[model samples]
Target: MIVVTTPTGRIGRHVLGHVLDGAEKVRVIVRDPERLPAPVRERVDVVRGSHDDPGVVAEALAGAGSVFWLIPPNPRAQSVQDHVIDFVRPLCTAIGDHGVERVVAVSTLGRGITRNAGLVSATYAMDDLIESTGVHYRSLCPPAFMENLLSQVETIRSRGTFFAPISADRRFLTCAVRDIAATAAALLLDGSWTGQDSVPIVGPDLLSYEEMAQIMTEVLQRPVRFQQISGEAFTAALRRAGVSEAWAGGGAAIMAATDRGTYVAEAGSPGPTAPTSFRQWCEEVLEPAVG
Candidate 1:
């Protein structure tokens, strides 16, 4: 049996879809089972409650051979570190009790190099805590998501401008969430691999926000451009967008670190690289969001 957390979310739903396409026995932990599409409802068993709840996870993981885990964002939480760790503590016990054989989790980049990286640091902590359980684990590490651009879709369409806290010319590698989901789905289906490892889901292009704007301009037929903002201003913007003050401040810290080149991919990767290109993401994802 395979258990999936956050099964209705953007990436998780896709993971569930790919797994369901195969012959694995599947169950899902969801806050609201009704949010699942009707077809998904008919196909899978579900435990309705937050996955972090001990009972929910225990019930979901019962007799399950593999687990696809994702910590759903809590933008309103008072503390980023506490939020992620608190959720993981329960699951660590459950994984041990259930004797699950394999685990796949979504984590971030900058594992060893990034310090005081706010939420990213918390994700690294999560990896440590889960791995200590001795479950065969795979950490799906991706940099900034290409879907983040969708947050600026309205501005890109109406004003042809988007905002960022990072400088225009600093290059960073990003991955499409589709690629991340694809990796998770593939791992969940294969029970042969053992031990712990990090899978870096890096897209093929290294791009700056300026290059991203140029691509969006060409793909969406709009003169999109990046406008840099102050760190505090970016935090305030995040708050205005509905994230709590603490979460927004952590986000600001991540932006500051990114601008300082803390997130630049190593000259040659030491892990797996995904196949999607930045321009391909623009044409497929950004263009549709703009429309």
Candidate 2:
């Protein structure tokens, strides 16, 4: 049996779709079952409760051989550390007690760095907690998600511009969430070998915001430019979008880190290579936005 948390999310949904055909016993932990798509809700066993609920975790883990775990960020969280610890502690204990052997956790590339990557600090702590349980664990340390680029679609359509704190020419590693989900699904289904492993999933190529803008414009057949914004402006924009101050500050910190090259993965790291490119993603996913 395999249990998935955050099954409605981007990566989780992909993971679920990848495994649903092969696995006979697949379950999803969802807070509200009614919110699930009809096909998804009908196909899997739905455990109606929060992943952080001990009883729910135990139930979800019962007789499960593998689990795909992802901790969603709480934008309203007062302190990031406190929110993460509170959420992970119980799930770790439940996994330990419930005899679930293998876990694939979604994390980010800059989690190990101490100076920057403020929000990723929580994922690093989660990796530690999951490792302590003596379960076979794989922590996926992926670079910037290409899906984040979707946020700019409306702006590009209306204003012919994508705004970000990242410099237009600053090259960075970015991977599609689909690739991350595929990697996690492969590990869960195979379950061949794992003790404690951190895989830095990188895209086939490194790209800059300017290059991305060009690709978007070509794919969408519209003129789009990358507009770099100040850190203060970025934070204010996030706050205006109703994101909490802590989350906005953390986002600003991450952008600053990106500017300093802290988010770039080391060359030749031992991890899976994702085949998707920014241009391909734009053609397949982002082009639909303008339609």
Candidate 3:
């Protein structure tokens, strides 16, 4: 049996779909089984609770061979590092107790390219803790999610503008969440790989906000503009959007790092690059969100 965590989340749902179709006996640890689609609920064994719980994880991992892992964001937690560590410790214990064969997890870029990046640093630390458990692991490290652009749909539709902390001239790296899920599903279905490693799931395009604005304009058939905001302003915006101060500050710090070119999309990633281009993502994801 294969176990999946966060099965109703964006990437998790997609991973579950692939696993279910692959005809693997699938089990999922979810807080609310009702959130799962009717078909999904009927198809898999469900442990109804958050994966961070020791009992919940132990129950889910029982008799499971491979696991798809993802730590859902806890923006309101007091400290990002503590939140992730608290969530991971139980999984570490469970992994050993259950003797899970292989694990795949969602992670971020800039492992060695940059240091002291708030959220990035915390997530890297989370990966380190999981790897120390000696479970065969694959950390799917991707740049900022292209889906983040979904948040700007209203602004793009109304004012023809969107905001970012990065400067217009700086080329930013991004990854489609679809690619992340696809890669994770591929890993989980296959049983051949061993040892520990990281896969960079960055998309092929390297774009500046200005260039992205141009593409959005062309794709949407409406004028669009890039508006660069200060780190403080971005942090405040995130705080207003209900991100905890610490995490919002970390997000701002990450933006500052990216703005400075700390992760230039090609620094530490030497593995498989995702096939989706920014334009394709915009056409497929952003345009639909805008509509």
Q: Which of the numbered candidates is closest to the native, going by highest TM-score?
A: 1
Global Cα lDDT for candidate 3: 0.88
Q: Tens digit of lDDT per residue, candidate 2, span 1-291?
A: 888888888899899988887755789999988878899898899999888788888888888889999988777777777777776887788877888889998988865564656677667888889898888999998878988877876888898898889898998888899999999888888767868888878887677899988888788888989999999999999889888888888888888888877655465443438889888888887888666
- The window of 10 residues in a row where model 3 has the poorest summed lDDT is 263-272
Model 2: how far residue 73 lies from native, Å = 2.6
- The per-model lDDT (C-alpha) reads 0.88, 0.83, 0.88
Backbone clashes counted, model 3 = 0
Q: Give candidates' CA RMSD values in order.
A: 1.2, 1.7, 1.4
Relative to the unseen true structure, what is the C-alpha lDDT of residue 18 in candidate 2, on a scale of 0 to 100? 86
- lDDT (0-100) at residue 135 of candidate 1? 93
Candidate 1 yields a Cα-based lDDT of 0.88
Candidate 3's residue-wise lDDT over 1-291, tens digit each?
A: 889998889899999999898868999999989999998899999998988899999999989989998988887877888888888888899999999999999988778667878878888887898899999999998988888888788999999999988899898788889899999999999989999998888888788889999999999999999999988899899899898998898888888988887657554354438988989998998998888
Candidate 1 Cα outliers beyond 4 Å, as residue runs: 268-272
Top-lDDT structure, candidate number: 1
Model 1 lDDT at residue 283: 86
Q: Look at candidate 1 and give me any clashing residue pairs.
A: none
Superposed by TM-score, candidate 1 places the C-alpha of residue 90 at a distance from the truth, in angstroms, of: 1.6
lDDT of 3 at 131: 95
